[model samples]
Target: MYPAADTATLLIDGKWLEADDGATFPVTAPATGELIGRAADAGAAETDRAIDAAAAAFGPWSAETAYARADVLRRAHDLMLERAEDLAVLMSTEQGKPLKAARNEVRYAADFLAWFAEEAKRVHGRTIPSNRRGHRFQVLKQPVGVVAGITPWNYPMSMITRKVAPAVAAGCTIVLKPAEQTPLCAVAVLALLEEAGLPPGVANLVTTARPEPVGERLLADPRVRKLTFTGSTEVGMRLAAGAAATMKRVSMELGGHAPMIVFDDADPVHAAKGATLAKFLNTGQACISPNRIYVQRGVVEAFTEALVARTATLSAGPGTSPGVSIGPLVDDAALTKVQRQVDDAVERGARLVLGGTRLTEDGLDRGCFFAPTVLADIDETMLIYREETFGPVAAVIPFDTEEEVVARANDTAYGLASYLYTRDLGRATRVSEALRFGIVGVNDINPTGAQAPFGGVGVSGLGREGGVEGLDEYLDVKLIGTAL
Candidate 1:
């Protein structure tokens, strides 16, 4: 057994501190089914302290030149690179993803830091065409002051970096609240930034089991000028509502039931593989992972066969185990939810193609390992087809024509990301434009990038998280007018 960490430190203001209430939230390893460490449970008072620190530092931190901020971010990026392996292992231990996948997440997380570091210097405001001859209009981008960053448990490191990097790049101080289940990655990042010589109170992290109290307090405080979060739609709505009372700027990357469509003209082999990977990434916990798949009737049989064959070869075990392609869900609650969805679908006449049974006899009987599942003959009545199955589950529905496929894909309330696999350039262009999602991937499983705008429409969430758009979330544009 690996040695358990003595404490999961909370970085508040400029120093690492313990909880004032003396309460500790235990971090459980989903793979080993054991408690790994106890993180400080930040109460309302502690959150206030962190927010105050962030507020106090905002003036100086945001006053720094873009190059200065870029330099500090770059140093932190280099530190992350040097410790990638250890960071990945720690992430896998906490998040229950395969070691290889965890390492990729670490690299992906570092990419955000490095890319945003350079982009910090490029946070440019535009000059508007003169409406009046005497008055010249110049738009200036200024920092949005202290930002409250709330990140989720899945893809812990990447999620935190995605939010924090952009806010820092835009020269905003931050008070971060990482998910209690996976707070270590954020703590690790805080340590790296501390080592990189970031100014005191510029960035602070507080872990709390009661996210509502902490979140409410942070947003309600007038000192916080911007709010960014990545989590469920319900909670996102509540936070957005709270932030609105103060008219604070808010950006959210919420839940998704993204669709993947396979046209009759597409290569079944390639489409099948791509869909499987996209649907199963992070055991299907990703917000943009393909949840509803529409396949053209002509190629449905072939695609189904290819998908089943590929999924059959996947292995499930602890993240450290050799050749383990998938790991357990985050906890028992997640497992129960997935199982209920499958059961409801079956009752609603949806056909289970593979993995209809729970792996109760496996070594992970007590763990949260649900079988990677595929469903067919699904209709709108089934909960599995309508709700977000944030687990290792995929529903395959066949469509007759392009119009039918497009209609079926857009039937859901979510418009986060969509996938279409076809080699035909004309068809690809038309369908990609037709899809309502903010981001559309054609023959690409990895739809997100540091340079791309990441957000969704309808119930998915509001605003954007990455790209130039993300930096805008942490800035206020002011028109500086002068007659020369």
Candidate 2:
């Protein structure tokens, strides 16, 4: 049994309590498959209690001045920095991201808190001219009450912060349901908010293996005015349908099969390096990660060779290990999925230039580790080219022209993110506009920040999650007409 110190209890109505049935589930480290701790396994009744708490606290929290809310967020940001090391270790242990990357994720999460803190006071309204004399018209902005945030296991800390920070800054109370595999990180974050003096019921957390009772109740409850989620497109569609029954506001950041195009005009070595970094970041588990690589025909061979050389240098092991360039996948299921995709591709005439198997080095036999692989001669019929490969596998397809590459890149139903590299400014500008994605990067692999709008078009999901647009997701606009 995990000791109390390693476990995460529920936070409901400002009180740390266990489930009504005293139910709990084990939290295992993906890197070692060892039991790290346990989390409260809350059900519908507990979710209802948390919702009631948020409903009760919403009035007072929303009534406070925007600056007052900003102060609380700023305090939380400072506390996050104070606890960054502990949080980073926790994330690395459970979520299987590299330690350095985990620490950076904490900083990124804190940045969101800081950004939203300033944005709270800047939620400005507009004045409109009225046709009638002695009449004035204006639009006002206010928080959307009681939010239910359902976040994924990948990037656990930042995902929660991205949703929670904006909700809190906009003067809304929230009930957060983190992914079952990684609730410990969420608990760590909740502790910081409490220490930062967030009022009781303003923020609550419930962890459970089953989403039925907890997640279902959260979506169905009318008191929960807005629902935000980051997960697969299949699950998002189901949640959206359910939330529609109550007509609650909904924002979702779903799955993606992002394409990375390397033009012949760009430096082969440079493009290859950037592509490798983008494809292997977070072990290629990110939604915006490059899944399909389109290299121009003239440089396909050179690009593929350089990509293999760079990828071969990446080390795979437990995230806590010192020089781990790649960490284990989140679980056995993820590992199996990646394996099946790679196997299918190799069987279908694709050449594996470098790694094409699972890794079991450095005590990684017990963990879910996959080798960084590169495949070439892939056509549209390959599964890795069509589906989203959420692993460290790069499938490079050759393109004859810019128009052909654009068409190939936009062939998928998902359009979350895409990237292109070319020295020709005209070509870069033209392709950037033509790509059907929410976020595009030209000569830049990582374009995300707290200051930009991050979201996708098509099946990638609805709404944005950063910048002024991010704050707007948690607020509602009202128009008023007054006679003077």
Judge candidate 1 against the unseen true structure and give its global Cα lDDT, from 0 to 1: 0.86
List model 1 lDDT by residue over 216-238, tens digit each.
Answer: 89888998998999999999989
User: What TM-score fits each model?
Assistant: 0.97, 0.98
- Name model 2 segments beyond 4 Å from true: 1-8
Candidate 2 local lDDT, 170-198, one digit each (tens): 99999999999999998988888888889
- lDDT score for residue 344 of model 1: 93
Clashes of each: 0, 0
RMSD (Å) of each candidate, 1 decimal: 2.2, 1.7
How far residue 400's Cα lies from its native spot in candidate 1, in Å, is 0.1
Pairs that collide, model 1:
none
The candidate scoring highest on TM-score is: 2
TM for candidate 2 is: 0.98
